[model samples]
Target: MSDRRLTPELLLGAYAAGVFPMAETRDASEIFWVDPERRGILPLDGFRMSRSLARRMRSGRFRATLDRSFPQVLDGCADRDETWINGTIRDLMLDLHALGPAHSFEVWEGEKLAGGMYGIALGGAFFGESMFSRVTDGSKMVLAAALDHLRRCGFTLFDTQFLTPHLASLGGVEITRAAYRARLARALADRASIDAIAMDGDLQAVVQRMTHTS
Candidate 1:
């Protein structure tokens, strides 16, 4: 193992290898690497949108955009009682975002940010780091947008890193590490981009594309 430091290059390499960094808590001084034996992944082809959520999206009460507010989105994700986003991780993410391997998806109601998610993209794989919602179903809405965006961009893998009941409810599943590595390998071999999808800040397209894909 290397006494690794966090940089855009190292971070992307870690992701391509099916490993990631985390802190024990928001205040932790050191970052640690986690390569779980069981990895959680959300398949691009299997993203599920419940009927009510789909209705909310179709109604167009909220709007969605990509890489619009990377910093705010990261802060939102780390704004919890306990978090893994320490100062070091925050700085590393900011640097990565500036370098284009990172991306953010935000849901909005008028001028207010309702919810958002931020993650890293390497080749055809997207590592969904964290998310936060300030309005009902906000995070979920952003997730739907992200799924549609990735699918349109020709992405093959979406790694959530771990599963929560919230994620599992929306088609996220766990695979053995070996399975994850195989999927990761395939994704790393392909090429994709967030902009490869024609999102164009169209909320309706977010719903329509997801519906068509799912």
Candidate 2:
């Protein structure tokens, strides 16, 4: 078992070092740091909005917002059957949120919270921690909006920790540890904020921008 006690300060330091903590299971008592040989990252300017995602974004059936309901978004992500977000990690993330470096991007379907994601933002890097969806295409739309927001906010790096099939489909790529550190150093040298740009605009604008760029 890890003897290290995770504090908000330590958590931030770990992220700065390009490592993150995870638990073996949702109920695990200890958290271990991960410094993967291959790191997954989504390029801020390279996120792909497929035809269906673009259509859904312009559908006007969903609305997106940032930091609207952070705790709710965290809960949604942790609600899955298998998760690494143990109690210790969850509470510490809450502490980080209160300290101002953590944020959530949410997608809503009318009165219901459809999907969202939460992550830690440091310098120009956004470490995507977790995401969840309750409706079809909910998570996809949220990702599209989140990437758009990141770019508009001047963020340069979007760290996904590890690549998954879903993320690869959306443009997440893996880099060797040495390569990732080079990118991370550059991102850390720069500064950015999630709220630097207002996320209050027509969702179609995001779709249009992605159509041109992606």
- Choose the strongest candidate by TM-score: 2
Global Cα lDDT for candidate 1: 0.87
lDDT per residue for candidate 1 within 1-214, as digits (tens), equals 2223667688778888888999988888888999999999998878788888878887867888888899999999999999999988898899899988888999999999999999998888999999999988998899888888888898999999999999999999999999999999999888787787556566677777777766
Over 158-202, each residue of candidate 2 has an lDDT whose tens digit, in order, gives 999999999999999999999999999999888787888799546
Q: Which ranges in model 1 have alpha carbons more than 4 Å from their true place?
A: 1-5
Candidates in order, TM-scores: namely: 0.94, 0.96
Report lDDT (Cα) of residue 24, candidate 2.
86
The superposed Cα distance between candidate 1 and the true structure at residue 109, in angstroms, equals 0.5
